[model samples]
Structure formats: structure tokens, C-alpha cells
Target chain A: MEQKTAIEAFAALAQETRLGVFRLLVQAGPDGLTAGDIAAHIGVPASTLSHHLGILERAGLLRSWRVQRQIYYATDYEGTRRLLAFLMEDCCRGLPELCGTALSDLVACCPKPTVDA
Target chain B: MEQKTAIEAFAALAQETRLGVFRLLVQAGPDGLTAGDIAAHIGVPASTLSHHLGILERAGLLRSWRVQRQIYYATDYEGTRRLLAFLMEDCCRGLPELCGTALSDLVACCPKPTVDA
Candidate 1:
């Protein structure tokens, strides 16, 4: 992803409500949660949730799809991965040597790359 | 780190100049770079560079220290790790079988954990 894209994604996540919403959608998986369900889960007014969701969508951190009458919002894994890749691009290239400490911490937090990866 | 800290860090990184400054510091490694050098490398005015540096420092993404007449700025690895950990906390816990795709992408971008890890 370009740095501008990365910046927008970061800005979208910088707010508490949006971050909570993103994590909730991430936990809810790729199928995501319907707007009503998300609002109920987050205990926010419909208007507030709508605003945050719009910001996330504009930033490309979340994607929404319509199934019947319901609109479900989920974390855009591709966009999310792109942002993650952008941030770690420089350090990971150096591998286990130069960025050792940070790299180790990152590895511990990140999962193993499966064959599909 | 608390969500507030993470928010601050993300906010600091949301801007182009600050993110450039941060990546420069990260690439510069733990030894960091002097304020003057950072300004020179980033090609920003002294005042603009200083302002951006202060924001990064306050947000806990960067740390500065005085060595003789120079003030060196470096990525605060622990603080950075905290933000990264916060972002990945929920998904990583679900492991390979769950948050799979995003996790795999993360792993591909991250390094392997050392024995000490």
C-alpha cells in the first residue's frame, strides 16, 4: 500500500470507537456483523455507529455487503494486511539481525505463515 | 499500553511527515539520529521538523536524549511494540485456526521469533 493509504488507515484506527468497532468486526470474522447487531454490541446510538463505520469504510479498513435487507460490515483483511505490511516493510527486510528485538516481539505476536501464505 | 496510548501513537503516525520521520528513525536503528540530522534527512524546515518530532515523542512513538550538544531521536521500540501488540492482541490469541488470513499476512511481514523469545 502507498504511504497515503497507510496514513488514512492509521487515522481511521486512531479513534476509540472505530478501533473498537474494527476489532469487534475482526473477531466476528469475515462474515462480519449486521449494522444493528454491531450497534447493539457496541452500545452506541445508531448515528454514532454509522459515522464511525463510514470513516472506516472510507479508509478501506472495513467493507460492507448487503445480504437481503441487512448490511454487514467486516474488517477488510486485504487492506488491513496491506497496512500491516507497509509498517513492517523496512524492519522485516533486515530480518533477525539488525531489528532483532523488535522483530522477535513481532514474531511472538504474529502467527506462523501457512502454506497458503 | 492503554488504548489511549495506542490512539496517540496512531495519531502521531497518521501524518505524512511524522510517519516519514518515524520510519527514518526506525531505519536509523536503536542508536537513532540527531535532531539536526533528522531535519536534514527529511528535508523539512527546522521548526516543522521540531514540531513533528515533539508530537511523535509525546505520542510515545519516539524518544529523544541529549548527548553533548546534540539531541538524538529514535523509535521507542517498547512503545512501538505496545501499539503493535494492541492492534494484534485479539486476532493473535485466536491463533492459526482462526484469524488465519490476516495472521498469515502478519507472519509473512514479521520475522521468526528467536530462541530467547
Candidate 2:
């Protein structure tokens, strides 16, 4: 990803409302959530959430489709992953060996929960 | 990291000049870069680089110290990692099992280049 695109993704996710919306959509999985559902969970007016969703889609962080006159939004996994890669690329200097420990440290921070329990 | 802190970090990195400076600093490794050297490499005046550097430091992406009457800056591993974690936390829902594939996919994108080459 180019610097400009990475910056746009960061800027898009930087807002509180936008961040919340993105998180909700991510958890909702590939099927995503309807626009109305997002607005309700976010506790914001439809217009307000719509504005945030527009920013997210523009940033390539989200993709939406109309199903029965209702908009369903889902996290753009590829786009989201691209942004994460962009952020980590510099940190690792694109050299995994050199940054092995650092990468390991970050992974450790993400402990797998006991989902099977 | 809070939304405010994330926004500040995003804003600091959103600028072209600042983004360049940050990547240079990150590549410079934990030792960071001297103010004068960064200014020279970035092809910016000392004042301009200083301004960009100030924003980076304030955003917690960097940490600097005075050594022998000169300031040296380096990427703050902890601070940087915190911001990354914040971005991923929601996507993973704090449940690694749910995001296992997504997490793996992102790691693959970081394919460790052959530093041995």
C-alpha cells in the first residue's frame, strides 16, 4: 500500500464513531450487518452513522451492498489486512529475521482466548 | 490507546513529510536518527524536520533523548505496539480463535524477506 492509502485508512479509523462502526462490522463477519442495525448498535442517527460508513468505504476499509433496499456493510478483510501490513512493514523493516523477536512480542500480546471452552 | 491518542498518531503520520520521517526513523532501528541527520536525509530544513519530529514524539510514535548536546530519536516500541494492538483488538474481538484466520492472513502478508540474500 502507498503512504497515502495507509494514511487515509488511519485517518478513517481514527474517529471514535467510525472506529466503533468498523469494529461492529468486523465482529459481524463477512455477512456484515445492515445499516439500520449498525445505527442502532452505535446509538446514532442513521445519517450520522451513514457519514461514518462513507468515510470507511472510501478508505477501502469497508464494502457495502444493497439487499432488499437495505444496505449491508462488511469489513473489507483484504483492505484491512493491507493497512495492517503497511503499518508493520516499516516496523519490521521488511526483514522478518531482524524483527523476529519484535514480531513475536506483538503476537504474544494477542493471546488466543479459550474459545473452545 | 484511546480514540484521542489514536487520532493524534494518525494525524501525525497522515502528513507526507511526517510519514517519510517516521519510516526513516523506523528503518534507523531503535537507535533512531539524529535531528541533523534526519533533516539532511529527509531533504528538509532543520526547523521543518524538527516540527515533524515534534508531532511524532507527541503522538507517542517516537521517543527522543539529548545525548552530547544533540537529540536522538527512536521508535517507541511499546507505544507503537499499543496503537497496533488497539487497531486489531476490535477486529479480533479480543478473541484470537475468531480472528485466527484473519490474523494468520495478515502475518503471511509480512513474509519475512531474505535478509540472508
Candidate 3:
């Protein structure tokens, strides 16, 4: 991602409501949630939530699709991956001993759910 | 990390200069760089860089220490971990099948430098 794009993504996540919306959609998974459900879950006004959603979409952190009269929103996995890649680009700049484990541990803390369990 | 702290960190990183500084320091590794060096590398006036550095430091994304009269800055590994953890908290929220690989693929993209190499 370019610096401008990265800045926009960071700005999108910098706000409380937008961050909440992103995380909510992330937890909602591929199926996503309708605008009404998101507003209800976040206890925000529909109009206000709509504004936040637009910002997130523009920043590439979210993808929204219209289903019937309602709109569904989900995390944009590819956009997210791009942002993460930009952050870790040339991480530690060759000092593997210092950051190899540190970066890995970021995701390690939240274990991926097992299929059998 | 609390929503407030996460917001602060994201906000700190949202700007062009601040983000550049953080990424530069990350590349610099644990030994960090002096404030003068950061200013010179980023091509910003020392006073302006100082302000940006303060915001980043307060947001917990960077740490600074005094080495003689020069203050050195480096990425704060703990704060970074907390932010990443917060982002991935309850990821997919039980829908492992959808996000199991997606989240892991984040750090996986940047191959850690091998010790023997």
C-alpha cells in the first residue's frame, strides 16, 4: 500500500466507532452483518453508523454489499492483508534475532480455532 | 489495550511524517537512532520531528532513551504486540474455518530473517 493509502487506513481505524465496526464485522466472519444489526450491536444511531461505514469502506478496511433493501458489511480480507504487509515490510531490517518471534507472537496470542474442537 | 489507547496509537500513525518515523525506527531495530538522525533521514526540521516523536511515544508505539545528550527512539515491542493482539482479539469469533489461515498469513508474508543466513 502507498503511504497515502496506509494513512487513510490508519485514520479509518483511529476512531472508536470505526474500529468497533471493523472488529464487529471481523467477528461476524464471511457472512457479515446488516447495517441494522451493526448499529444495534454498537448502540449507535443508524445515520452515524452509516457515516462510519462509509469511511471504513473508502479506506479499504471494509466491503459492503446490498442484499434486498438491506446492506451487508464484512471485513475486506485482501485490503487488511495489504495493510498488514505494508506495516511489516522489511521488519527489523535484518535483525531476525530481535523481531522474528515478536512479530509472530502478535498472531500467536489469539489462537486460531481448531476444526475438531 | 483499551479503546482509548488503541485510538491514540492509530491516530499517531495516521499522519505521513509520524508513520515514516515509526517505520524508520522499526527498521533501525533495538539500538534505535538519535533524534538528529531521525530528523535527518525523514528530512523534517528537528522541532517538527520532535512533536511527531512525542505523539508516537505517548501512543505507546515508540520508546525513547537518553544516550548522553541525544535522545534515541525505537519501536516499542510490547505496545506493538498489544495493538496487534487487540486487532486480532476473538478474530472470526468462532468461525475458524474462514479466518484460520487469513490471520496467520499476515506475519507469514514477511519471512523472518534466518539466524544462520
Candidate 4:
């Protein structure tokens, strides 16, 4: 998590279209989405979406693979974790208690739905 | 958690100096640091650092308050959480088991230093 790398990751998500794409991919999960599907869901032209995807992949926030002729993209969880670790490195400086709970909640992720009786 | 807001936060941290400043404040913890200290530590001039600080504060990544004559900046944990929540929102879309553990590691900050004989 070098400073330069972190900045690149931040820059990758700084745009509205790119941010939306990343979120969509995150929600899409391990299965990921093909570039065409992503472009369609995001209501952007394929050409435009391709550029954004390239930026994200270069920033290490995304990973892509080809299935036959279609290229799929998924959120790079390891890259994401690295970015988060860099942001929170040395947090509270040996006193995790000061920021642990609040920060930990960030990772709580999708809460389970409750059923009605 | 709005798309625009998330973009703003990402943009705020995309720059080198700003990222350094934010990391410094995160390390500084709740006590924060004065603008002067931040500039000195980051090796940037007061005027330049002031501009970056203003951007980060507006994006909600950092919070600033005045004490007597000096202004202090600290990482806004609430804001950080919000940004992270947005990033991981619907993460795995109800399948927390898919991403929970990995994401949870993000909050495992500030590991205690080991003691040796």
C-alpha cells in the first residue's frame, strides 16, 4: 500500500460513472459481470464504460477475465483490503480500543433480513 | 452515501498531499493535529495544505475545529464509516458469508506491538 498506489485507487473511484460501476460489481459479487452487462446496467455506452473499466483495473481496484469473447470484471477484494489497510494503518497508534468498534462496523457488511411472523 | 458524496470523498483523497494529510490525522487519532503541525509533518506549505485540508473537510473525510487560535483536523470516523458503508453496501447482497470475513479485516487496525524478553 504505497502512497502512490493508494492515490491511484482513490483516483479510480473518484468519478461518478466509475464509482457506480465499482458498486455494481461489488454487489454482483464473485460471479462478476461482463463488460457489456455492466455498460447496459449502468446506462453508459460500451466505449465509455471500457475506458472507466481500464482505469479501475489499472488502479488495482478491479480484475478482469475473458469468458469466450466476453470480458468479465469483478471487484478485487485483496486490492480493496489493501487500500483499506493503508487508510487505517497505525490507527490510534497501538490503542485500537479508541477506534476499533467504530471502524470495525465498516466491515459488518450486508445485514441479514428479518422475517415477519 | 449518495453517489456524488462518495465521489467527492474519493476525489478528496486522490491527491498525494491530501492522502498524506488524512493518513497523518488518522494516525493522530481523536486528538487530531493542528494545521501547522500537519503542514510541517507533511512538508507542505501552510497555504497549500490549507487548500487540501478544506477539500478533505468538505468531503467529510476530515473534521476540523478551532481551539483558541489554532485549527485542529481529525479523521471523521463517522464519515469514514459512511464512505466505507457505501462502498460495501449490499456487499454480497445478503450473502455476508461471501465477503464478511475479508471485509471485517479492514477494521482490525492497530495491532498491539509484541513484547520480547
Tens digit of per-residue lDDT, candidate 3, span A1-117: 698999999999999999998878876777899999999999999999999999999999899899999999998877887776666566666546766566555533122311210
lDDT on C-alpha atoms for all candidate structures: 0.74, 0.71, 0.78, 0.80
* Fraction of the reference Cα-Cα interface contacts (below 8 Å) that each candidate reproduces: 0.39, 0.30, 0.57, 0.75
Q: Is candidate 2 or candidate 4 better by DockQ?
A: 4
Higher-TM-score candidate of 1 and 3 = 3
RMSD (Cα, Å) of candidate 2?
Answer: 7.8
Cα lDDT tens digits for candidate 1, A1-117: 678888999999999888888878766767788999999998999999999999999998899999999899987877777676567555523534555566454632222221211
> A22-103, model 2: which lDDT tens digit per residue?
8677666677899999999989999889999999999999999999989999888778776765555545344445443544
For model 4, state the Cα shift of residue B61 in Å.
1.0
Regions of candidate 1 where Cα sits further than 4 Å from its true position: A92-95, A107-117, B92-95, B105-117
Distance from true position, residue A45, model 3, in Å? 1.5
Candidate 1 CAPRI level: acceptable
Q: List the residue pairs that clash in candidate 4.
A: none
lDDT of 4: 0.80
List, residue by residue over B1-117, the lDDT tens digit for candidate 4: 688999999999999999999988877888999999998999998999999999999999999899999999998987888787778666666565566565545532112211110
> Chain A only: TM-score of every candidate?
0.83, 0.81, 0.86, 0.87
C-alpha DockQ of every model: 0.43, 0.30, 0.47, 0.49
Q: List residue ranges in candidate 3 displaced over 4 A.
A: A107-117, B107-117
TM-score of chain A of 3: 0.86
Report the lDDT tens digits of candidate 4 across residue range A1-117.
689999999999999999999989887877899999999999999899999999999999899999999999998887887787777777666465667566655532112111111
Model 3 deviation from native, Cα RMSD in Å: 7.1
Candidate 2 C-alpha error for residue A7, in Å: 1.7
* lDDT value, residue B18 of candidate 2: 85
Interface RMSD against the true structure, candidate 1: 2.8
